[model samples]
Target: MSSKPLLLLTPALAVIGLLFGGGLALALLQSVGYLAALGQTTLTLDAYRQLLSDPVFGRSLLLTLWIAVASTAVSTLLALMAALTLRRSFRARPVATFIFQSNLPIPHLVGAIGILLLFSQSGFLARLSHLLGLIQQPADFPALVFDPYGLGIMLEYIWKS
Candidate 1:
């Protein structure tokens, strides 16, 4: 009986091993080629040296790191708040969970577009402002979408994630 179960599981295990092992082998080969010159086959750290000296690459790396750190911190805080709130009140628990889980079904790009539509100068909010006499035209509204500070991306993350 035990042998039968093992036999049945063998193919699945082999498939998983092949998938992961193939990927690892490809990555290893690529990394080796990347670390060494193809013609001379001499190992060198030239790529790493270049990466460290490139200002644009450095700036992008720093921006990525900042975004990762900020997102992690915010997610931790939000998770704690959600847990505490759930413990205190059960009334909106289902609704809150539904809203949070619903975000998973929406693509990131769609969420970004929604944020842009809602918060951009020519967006729904701006139109509402115009209707309310807060702004004479959309062009008079301040920029929110694609701002240098990445407020649009942050808003999208907050809404979706």
Candidate 2:
């Protein structure tokens, strides 16, 4: 509303615009195979056609469905439970409420990486499983990284936002 506040917000807004807008432009270019350094500047739909014909891409579609459903269920359940828990009066209700929403301040990238490190095929859980003899090799572990069920991605979504 004022010149002072406008001046204060200008730099932050500029940085955010540059980062988000530039990344989006780059992604749009790459989606059509326009990476000049890689000599892939053909800008064709061949990549999309390849994905359509690949079984793994089909499986990825299924995995995306799984991630969406699981993340929605988990976040909704957590929100409902938190609301119920905070409904009643208690000495520590304020603290509990803040704790319930603590994840809101976390960056999405950090939360996603945290989930990956904790749950991916070669992640903490995998190493723990190996140490405990629960799995014989890395391949023996469940496909939580790029799984049909998207276990890692679901956890990331639920934890991040």
Candidate 3:
């Protein structure tokens, strides 16, 4: 009921307005071509229009949408199956639960590096393959790290999620 409550809220409100509001405003301005540093002062929808009109852009957008949908569907299915199995009785239930959840606590960067170490062409798998005569050299192994289909990324997603 006193001025103290208003004073206490003022600084918090100002900080939120300065940080969150400023960030949103900056993003909106830059998205509409208002980046002074980049010399993009004109505000126009030409970029958006071009992206929509270009056939290559359209194909890329469709492919992105397809990958998103497929990844989501598969992730959901796999999660459901895991959930069902975890709730049922099994001898190695503890081990299964541990394996399913171990990735949860891991940082995303660590998980990504783990995936790279295991799956990259010059990774442990590739080196082992070479030693086992599966491939003459690590470089000769198929490029799985940055392949067009991004299988390594998908595997990382599945393992982490």
Please give the CA lDDT of all the candidate structures: 0.78, 0.84, 0.84
Query: Candidate 2 on 1-161: residue-level lDDT in tens?
Result: 56999899999999999999999999989998899988877889888898899998888788778778879999899878878989999999989978867888888888888877877778888889999999997557777777656677777787765
Ten contiguous residues with the weakest lDDT in model 3 = 62-71
Question: What are the per-residue Cα lDDT tens digits for candidate 3 across 1-161?
Answer: 68999899999999998999999999988877798998889998877887889999987776677656766778889999999999999999999999998889898788789989988998999999999999999988887778766667667777778
lDDT of 1: 0.78
91 in model 3: Cα distance from truth in Å?
A: 2.3
**Residue 19 miss distance in model 1 (angstroms):** 2.9
1 or 2, greater by TM-score? 1
Better of 1 and 3 by lDDT: 3
Off by over 4 Å in 2: 1-51, 120-148
Tens-digit per-residue lDDT, 37-128, candidate 1: 45645555666788889998988887777766776678778878877876776788889877767888889999988888889998999999
Name every residue pair that clashes in candidate 1: none
Comparison by lDDT, 1 against 2, better one? 2
**Clash count for each candidate, listed in order shown:** 0, 0, 0
TM-score each candidate: 0.69, 0.54, 0.70
What's the true lDDT of residue 75 in model 2? 88
Error of 1 at 108 (Å): 1.7
Q: By lDDT, is 2 or 3 better?
A: 3
Looking at model 2, report the run of 10 residues with the lowest lDDT sum.
Answer: 144-153
